[model samples]
Target: MITVNAPYAVAVHEGNDFTANPPHTSIWGLLYAQVKQADGLDYRNILLNESEMKLKPKRKQDEIFSTFMQEAEERRAEDIRLNVRHPHKVDATAIMQDVMQQMTIEKHNDQSAFCVWSNKEVQEILELYGLPVDSSLSILCVEVFGQVNNTYEHIDDFAINKSSLIKNTEKEFGSEVALEYNRTIDVVGPQPPKRPIDPLNSHLGMHRILRTSPLTEVPFVCCTD
Candidate 1:
């Protein structure tokens, strides 16, 4: 019986009352705030009403501080969880090469400015150019960047105890099982079998898993064609 635009619908449903109160699209207003915040001209401290319009005559110091602090805290939390808030459009490989060239100075820059790569950036670069690079070298590069950035401050706030892994198992099975549990966690598992060069199934090539028959000690390939 009643049909309005999507924006109107959102405004109505998201607010306390569509007629008396309405929610403002603060995200749209964020562009303006970003310009001000980045420009270091955030003196006005525009306060949004329930309808999202700027409150007149600017906000008080306490309100401005409170709002800015809350925003900063939220952004910091997001950066920790996400690693990178904004993805630079620059060529990552080229940047990595340049950074690697200026390793000493670049390391300092990363530490001071938090120039660490985001998870998305890392994944994207690796997917594009990972095949030629050795896995160890790739890991080392990331480690160096991580050390410089120290971006895990939020995640590191919570420490994980090694004992927590096997606490329950230790009670039930004693120290030996707990030691084994630790070993299992620390030890590397067996690697997959090398894929044979089967021209017949060349297109279907994959890292094959080794499996053994119940009655036999011999192993056979158990993956792909």
Candidate 2:
């Protein structure tokens, strides 16, 4: 939690799978929380990408998006459990319903979505600035590409590595199916490069972990020392 000093900005990003029924995203910004003052502690939340920031038009949008994300998360968890347990009796319909219930609970928990700062707008803005849809180094992408060319080339090199994904699936399912998947992935390409972001900078100067400044400050309070 960063202290709100005067005013600052924060970057916004959309959830990876915003195409889902309920959309979700994130807000990256500087938060300031000031110490004691006449007007109470100062607080400020500044949008870094103000130009491209998209505020949700309808209040229900938040509800829908929150529900979708929670349900998806729950379903993902269930999938993991099923994969691990290898249950003999599988009820797809029941699993879906349970996940839906979880989504509904999430929606009810925050109707106003007052705490949600991320949305699709931010994601679009980031994309406009050439940030890849699925990038791990979001901050660096914003700082380097967003500042330089405003277009960071997304490079993906596929190479063949240990067939963990296929092997795992095959173990859970069976050898025949796993072999089919393995063949498919092999057709796709090879394993990824050692450093994904290494291509971003050809000539390295100083590799610094980009970060937003924590703009929080506490003023001096004097009583009787």
Candidate 3:
């Protein structure tokens, strides 16, 4: 019997048999058929099992699993985005009503007494409902109150004005809610009186003085001013 190295054995068995007849069978095919017939086992299955076992190390190093995990995470994020509620659909009226009710029970002794809601508080409410938290929500607060600067102020923090909130609540929900809200306020007792305003403290007052003053040559102040 001759001993053939594994590489040479494979080359000799699998290589083309140019000298064979038209119906020629390969050496590897004959060996596989003999093994199957004798032991009821496929050489292909045996080789495949061995190959898989050898490749176990390589499989551990592969990025395919990590790639699949990343794809799964991305799909989950997309699903969340698609399923989240729209910002406009949020019940601003109801939220404002709730805020009003809460304000009735709470005391505000500081300058923020007029503030009915903060930007941070609104963000938390939106997040609780699975809605996107953004500056658009601040705009929605302004829309609910019917005015900006007078109703909403964004200094270091966004704040909604209590007076504007009351006026808008009356406008949106009609007289009954407004009357009830007024009664609630009466029970809570009067808020501290607002400080008196100096007309000269405002930009409009400054602009008026600039436009009408005899010393000034410019007759028109830009509307933007």
Candidate 4:
């Protein structure tokens, strides 16, 4: 059970039915409550405007909604700009170095060139490296080099390939690091298929991971161990 102390709390308790005649006091009250609960003054102002508009004539409600939505969108755009300008302190260089090092070590030990790090493992690595323990960092790294499966069982495991990793490293960490990393790993391209592969025909016995290059718009195979 949950308890709300505000006078408009009942509006939220009994949900608003917008279809009803003489629009429910619920919308007005709810907007008022949202205005009070809003974090930023700009957002609060929008909510306050919306709450006041709810009390106006029915014909004007649509205009209010349109205006309010525009303001909300502008606010969201401004927030995104601010965030891009001042992102979290993530040491991409250090993180990439550690990831490459780990991948190399794993390849040498197991004869497997690919590395699949689970969400838990990635978080642990972040902590161990004295880096910020942000889950998005794991997603970012995985997205740069691999595809994340949609299924629940494999979704947490990020399988990163060497080629894509190097490509992304070059893009993000500069040519010097990328060149050294590529040389250190002894980069080898995967061989082409003998026959034309049909994706729908699973029994054709050709199983390859395909990744498209953003710059070239060309598809290439990502070799596994």
The backbone clash count of each candidate, in order, is: 0, 16, 0, 0
Task: Give a tens-digit lDDT track for model 4, residues 72-147.
Answer: 5566677777876744344445445555655555333311111233345544554664445431220100001122
The local lDDT score (0 to 100) that residue 63 gets in candidate 3 is 45
Q: Which wins on lDDT, candidate 1 or candidate 2?
A: 2
- Runs in model 4 with CA error above 4 Å? 1-160, 187-225
lDDT of 1 by residue, 1-225 (tens): 101111111213654444211111111011000113456856322211111112122234445445545655676677777778563333444444544445444322211111232334433443564222111111100011011122112122112544564687799999999989778655533333433232113322332322111211112223321
The alpha-carbon lDDT assigned to residue 31 of candidate 3 equals: 8
Residue 101 lDDT in candidate 4: 58
Alpha-carbon TM-score of each model against the true structure: 0.17, 0.20, 0.15, 0.14
Q: What Cα-based lDDT does every candidate model obtain?
A: 0.31, 0.37, 0.30, 0.34
Point out where model 3 deviates above 4 Å. 1-160, 191-225
TM-score (C-alpha) between model 1 and the true structure:
0.17
List candidate 1 stretches off by more than 4 Å: 1-65, 68-161, 188-225
1-225 per-residue lDDT for model 2 (tens digits): 111111112233573321211122222232122223357665323223311122233335445555655666676678788795643334455555665666666544321111122435434544665554332211111121121211111211113223566678788999999988777765645433323232123423433333333443323333211
Q: How many clashes does the backbone of model 4 have?
A: 0
| Residue pairs whose backbone atoms clash in candidate 4 | none
Report the Cα lDDT for candidate 2.
Answer: 0.37
Model 3: residue 133 alpha-carbon error in angstroms: 50
